[model samples]
Target chain A: MIKIEHLSYHYSNGEQGINDISIEINSSTSLAIIGPNGSGKSTFIKCLMGILKPQRGSIILNNQNINKLSITQRSQHIGFVFQDPKEQLFKSTIEQEIRFALRKRKDQKDIESQVETILECCSLTSHRSKHPYDVSITQQKFILIGCALGMNQDIIIMDEPTSGMDYKGIKQLAKIVEFLKKEKKTIIMVSHDLDFISEHFENVMIINHHQCIYQGTFKDACRDETVLSQGEYKLPDIARLSLMAKHQLCTTHQEWIELWKKR
Target chain B: MAQLELSNFSFRYQGSQDYVLKDINLTLKSGQFTLINGLDGAGKTTLGYALKGIIPHVFEGTLLGEQRLNHKVFQEYTHQELTKIIGYCFQNPWTQLSMIKSTLEEELSFSCENVGYALEETRFRVKAIVRLLDLSHLIHKNPIHLSLGQLQTIALGTILVLDPDVLILDEPTSQLDPLTRRRLFNHLSDLKKQGKTIILIEHNIDDFLELVDHLVLLEKGSILDQGSVIDVYTRSLSIGRDIQYPSLTALLSTITSLDKPILNDNDALTILKGVKSHD
Candidate 1:
């Protein structure tokens, strides 16, 4: 379980990044953080990843205070895929990038095997030897996800993973999320891709103007016109389509179809 | 109105034996809104380079065809003339920004300045683009401090400042939220009414379906499909191609069978309700 309390962070120039906000995330639930661009979603994510220190707050993870944890110790608990893949991708080759993440792993045994597994899962096996920059931007995103998978952390956080990705790439990522869930890994996604989020995640966190305005299931978030307006989000396509016929919120296409049929 | 035509065009990058674009025969008429989509590495960007005159000029390669604007070859046009006529916004917004500019306004003005516009003319175009794109909120903010979505808007605004006849944007909405996207969509619709040719390459076709006049699908350096938006979209769906299927259309097709394309939310509501009444 992860607990956050009174979280606040201000930039060096004294501009508020995020105001006092608090939330608790259970390990069993995956989370999607939804908000408009520059709405402090990145600020909140950075604070969680320890990239940006919170000026005032407490983040408790499984009874451990993350503020006191070392970077290496934190890596054991959290893996991050940046919003821009370029920030996280630096190695010469795609293969080397994934291996670099596994360098600190104590299990020297399955390193090569693990690398192979991630490459295949990411559909990057054919391009393993190519330079990360040489591959298409969509492939670079997969490389980032592969690196995070290589870390094998308890919590995997992906930021805007679907940005600039084709439909095929998005489907591949959906599969990856399923695989992670089956492994019991807690996933946190910060993205504007509401359609993707609605399909995969049940819970949502809405941030706006550097504040946590709402935290609950996606259905509740959708029902609230104020929350949607505050966060600058549209109704996910499926929900909008379903709501056109009925008042109920439907998460998936099949579910919407079932609801309509029953009605 | 300028008509851009590509006739038997094929290009192969230097040192590569394979052609990235193969015998592409197409015409983009004046005021036509074309939407193109495909999987990653589908040569959509390469096609953009070809259409924008960057292929024969900037990229070294083997070429076996002709690209003409208004009956003149692209090579005939001066670089400055091409810049005035065709404005290409790249996939990566950061690369398009002139980092030398401090604020968003200056960054937009830089495009006109680079095209050799006078100070007064540059200012006029910059102001017009800002108002048209609704960039008043971030006009004075430093571009370096701006977020990715903000930078994307600034980058696009810079191109619009030039007021090119043909605007080619590579996934402009990738980073934008719904409100900003609608703003862009509205602006583009207005631009279309002004008779500017708009060719948009995107991974998400949901927002701009109504704006698409023609649709093309590229795959592995070949034009897999091209036609009216509904025909191409329905064909693409039938074949299970990798093109981005509009979510509402996909759902409606799976659950309910509406012969006509479900272009938007209203289309689904009206079409499904009409079908049920008939039954």
Candidate 2:
């Protein structure tokens, strides 16, 4: 479990990145952080990742303060996928990248088999031997996710994982996410892709104007009209339809289809 | 004139043995908004580069067949001259920044100044673009300090200042907030009305479906299909391929009785309600 208390970060330019924000993330559940562009979502994630030290507040992981942990130690507990794939990917080949992430594991046996499982999960088996840059941008994203999974970190963080991915790539990612959830891993993501969020995440934290405007279930947040203004968000397609339908607030295609079948 | 055409087009990057793009053909007319989409690794970016004149000029490659802009061939126009006619926004907005310039205003005007536009004309165009993109607040700040969304707007601004007749934007709204995405589309719509052609490559063609005159689906470095949005999307879906539609469009398509794809929420509600009544 991870807990944050009154976390705040101010840029050197005197602009506040995030202001006095606090939220608790339970293990085995997904939490999505969303807000307008440049609205402190990334800033909060950075503080959590130890890339940026908070001027105020603290982050405790399993009762130990994350601030005290070294960057390498912090990385062991938390696996991070950067918004830009280029930032996180450096290995020569996709398969090699996953193998590299699995380096810290104590188990000597079944290493190759474990890499195979991760490759299949990421739908990157076909491209295993290919260079990271040779593949599409979306494939690079999966490679990063694959590395994170291979690391076997308790907590996984993805920043804008769905940006350039297409329908097929997204389905593949959703499948892997389901696999991860089954393993009871704590998943956190920051994204502008609302449909993906609506389908996968239950809890959402809305940061706007350098503060947490709302922290609750996505369904509740969608019903709250204030979320739309405070977070500078336009209602996503499914949310808009769900609002207009006024039956049950639906956020996914399956939910919408089921609601239609009822009506 | 102002038409882009390719015939039997293929390209292989200099070092690579395999052709990454193959057997592609397209004719984009003036003022048409064409959307190129497919799954990742489908050579969409390579296709964009081919159309943008970046392929043969910037990247060394084995180019086959022909690419024509207006009545002239690509070789006929110098790289500088091409900028006057075509503005291409890259998939990665960060790379689009002219890092030499510190301030956003200077970055936006770099293209205009480089192209030898008169001082008064450059100022006029830059001002107009800033206003169109709602970028006044960030004009003085260093662009490197801006977020991806802000940088995307500024990157597009850098292209818009050239007053190019055709704009090729790849995933331009990937980082933008929904409202900003809507606003950016609105500006593009305005530009479309003014007779500038647009070629957009994106995974989710949700917000700007109305603006898309043509939809081309790429699969594994080839054209899977190309035509009106509904025809191509529905045809692809029939073959058990997910071409990726907006949530509303996807929802509407689930009902087999719907005559055509609809985007508006109220219309979707009406069609869904009617389907229920018939049941």
Candidate 3:
């Protein structure tokens, strides 16, 4: 659904331009891009969204060079959720924001029904009247997702959606992602929450030193010691516990409980 | 003596009808690690500001009780005096940083210059704090251009250079990644061991459960519960309210069926592993 080739772009400050990056994202699948603070992950996503035009490279969406299309035209094919919630939300209420996005391309007769369906799928009906900025960061994220879904864009890119959320909040987001999966909306998320990505996302991409170093299944990529060390990432808690058991630090928790019972 | 104390305190922001904090009573001794846990909009930040004398002073609110820092009544102390005794890092670190600086070193000097510290002493303090936080590499980076994690470290470095008796942070790890969050907590843990009184307003219980000596829960601007870490979790769980313990604690709570629930991450891990062993 999304493709980038030999992409090279630099900031106005003259920092390195993505360093000839090339990658492809399949349709109806999720890809998580992970990296350290300044590894150009955000730059890569922006180029894909056509927010920044790569100086020397081609970005193709559905077999057409995105460089040839206008920003709004590219947005019809790609939807982006920024890292900062405040940047994405300017509407008075949650319903109004989703409605505004729907009104752009949706027919006037079908707008209300489409808005309702997306809001329901995103679990934002209860907060329809509430201002987008007034809601919690977690809820603001869902509101963004609802607006993106309203556009019914082919590919949705989310940046750091789980940075400040608690367990309950993270679970709430995961449930929405699950629904998107069923709806076959291709997803690309930039997350530092390794555990969240490993559990939910099928495909993982590790961007290190301004290059795509690893891309594969979440389980395989996370367990790779090289990627973990280079990206400063850690395995999920369950995987870490399983690794500890291999070292004979301790057996399963159930085994220890049984021994205590006998004692 | 407690570094901070609040007794029967209540506060409601001006122009608001209801109190954001109600009937709060607690004491935090110097050199102890304390965690303040609460749900969204539960007045955790309100209580943090109240402890730092920001409630009635910076934020116009009705105050209905006594608060003291280092045995000095909060109302009796000047804002400068409060700054010396208590260092409060607001939830948003960006707002707290006020200097037009390009580097972390310059940011530290901005604080020192404002306080009129001698040049030699300011340099020494800045170097010491930078080394303490392992921020030697970032000493020259632009504060605005830094990442969220780096900005948090710089914010903390600026505060620690002042050497306040009590350090209160509101959601310090809310914007950091897992790796950065771990590093930040390690720095806090080291500060606690060095006899710095630390108060953290946070929701990431899994990271700090084992380090916190006391746990306080707030709801709708009222003190819902406060006690030792284990006591608060146990009491809340017995009443059927979900305590904000780590995942391991929740799992063990189900297996043991005990009224006295544990909230510490290390304790919960031990218990969960034991259960797994038995089964």
User: Which candidate number has the best lDDT?
Assistant: 1
lDDT tens per residue, model 3, B1-279: 148899899988887788888888888988888888877668788889988888777999788889988777887888887887788887666766875887789998787776778999999999898888777877886776565556776787778888877899987776666666778778788888878899998877777877889888877777788888878877877887864665555545545665666554465456546553332
Where does candidate 3 stray beyond 4 Å? A68-70, A105-109, A113-131, A242-263, B237-239, B251-279
TM-score: model 3, chain A: 0.86
**Residue pairs in collision within model 2:** none
Worst 10 residues of 2 chain A by lDDT: A254-263
> Of models 1 and 2, which has the larger TM-score?
1
lDDT string, candidate 2, B113-201, tens digits: 88898889988998998898888988988876777777888888899888789899988888888778888889899889998889999
DockQ of model 3 vs. true complex: 0.31
Model 3, residue A81: what's the lDDT? 85
Sorting all predicted structures by DockQ, with the top scorer first, yields 2, 1, 3
The residue-by-residue lDDT of candidate 2 on A17-135, one tens digit each, is: 89999999999999999888878888889889989889999999999988867668799889999988998888889999999998977776767888998899888899999999888
Model 3's chain B yields a TM-score of 0.89
Better of 1 and 2 by lDDT: 1
Q: What is the TM-score of chain B in candidate 2?
A: 0.92
lDDT of each: 0.86, 0.84, 0.76
DockQ of each: 0.56, 0.57, 0.31
* Native contacts retained, all candidates in order: 0.62, 0.67, 0.23
List the candidate numbers ranked by lDDT, top first: 1, 2, 3
